[model samples]
Target: MAVDVLNESNWAVEPRVFSDLGLWVMDQMKISTDCDLTIIFNEPDAMEELHLRWMNLEGPTDVMSFPMDELRPGDGTTDVEGMLGDIVLCPAVAATQAQSAGHSTIEELMLLTIHGCLHLLGFDHSDKDQEKEMFGIQRQLLLTYLAARPGELNEVIPLEISGE
Candidate 1:
């Protein structure tokens, strides 16, 4: 998968974190295609638009997904290879949420990326059962990612959204 990260937001984030997120998403999903994923950081106001359009809310959301195609079983056709989708993140919202959740902004961003990627992979948390399954897997993947790099460990923070 080709993961492209674009930082257009006013907030600051390390580039390597974005790359790590791409790898984590690919590994967790077991997606073995030349998928192209773009992580764009947009203005907080832009996210408000998404909140109104997608979630029917009046405020900004942490992340949004724009899948290019519906999730389908892979065919033998290698024409498209694999183009999963694009995940747009609002760093400002992430930062704010991170502060409220008492965690680093990077952790918040990573969680948002994982959440968006899960949506692209057809994981939704709108229902109770689905929320448990999806959030459980998200936390597992996040713990794995964090454990792999112990040097970067700052704290064992809890996730904002729980499996329950």
Candidate 2:
């Protein structure tokens, strides 16, 4: 997977970690190595504009996904490869949610990163059953990702989505 991270936020972000997280998600989804993914950390203003234009929402959201190829996870084939799309994240907004959720800003960003990638891969929580399946896979992937990096575990807790 070709993963690129563009940080345009005021806060300092570990771009490599975001790249690794994106790649790991692709691996877990069995996407081909030829696929491309980009993660963008933007200021709240930029995010708000995007939210208004694309989603027609009024404010900055935590994360937004723009999928290019409409790839779905675990189709069990890598015969096709293309741009997976961009995950635009607003750290400024995530910080507020992190405080409420009792986790570090980085942890919240990580969770949002995974959540955004899942969306790019055609995962959604449009209904109760979809929420269960998506959040279950999300939590499992996050836990495994955290467990694999014990040192980074200090930087992140086991994230618990409120409704999951």
Candidate 3:
């Protein structure tokens, strides 16, 4: 997968980290490596505008997903691929969340990235049943990713999501 990351915020965003993680995530989802995805880091102002415009909410959110191809996790034998869509992230909001959750900002960003990808894959947590399924998958993905790439991780990031 071609994972492109753009930093438009003042925060120190590491494009490679997100790109690599995104690619791995798509692979895990049985998506073709030819797929393209974009992750953009925006400031609070831009995020707030998007939150209001898209969700009719008043505050900036940590992440928002705009899906393109409306893709789903492929069947085990299919190599699904397409323009998966964009994940707009607010690092500033994530930093505050990280602080409150007692973890590094990067960890929060990673979780958000995973959440955003799942969204692009047609996952939602609007209801309890949906939340259970989504969060469980999320937890498994994070734990597996962390275990497989300990060298890339500085520490065992505490799971901050309402994931089982």
Best candidate, TM-score-wise?
A: 3
1-164: candidate 3 lDDT, tens digit per residue? 39989988877666778898898889899987678899999989999999999999999999999999999998989989788999999988998998999988888899999999999999999999999999998888887988898766554343233233
Report residue 68 deviation for candidate 2 (angstroms). 0.2
Candidate 1's C-alpha runs over 4 A off are 72-81, 153-164
Clashing pairs in 1: none
Q: After superposition, how far is residue 68 of candidate 3 from its true place, in Å?
A: 0.3
lDDT ranking of the models:
3, 2, 1
lDDT of 2 by residue, 1-164 (tens): 39989978777676778888898888888876568899998888999999999999998999999999998776666534678999999988998999999988888888899999899988999999999998998888888999899888465333333244
The local distance difference test score of model 3 is 0.87
Q: How many angstroms is residue 63 displaced in model 3 relative to the true structure, after the best TM-score fit?
A: 0.4
**Tens-place lDDT digits, model 1, residues 3-48:** 8788777665565677666766675566644577788888889889
Candidate 2 stretches greater than 4 Å from native: 77-80, 153-164
Off by over 4 Å in 3: 155-164
- lDDT to native, each model: 0.75, 0.85, 0.87
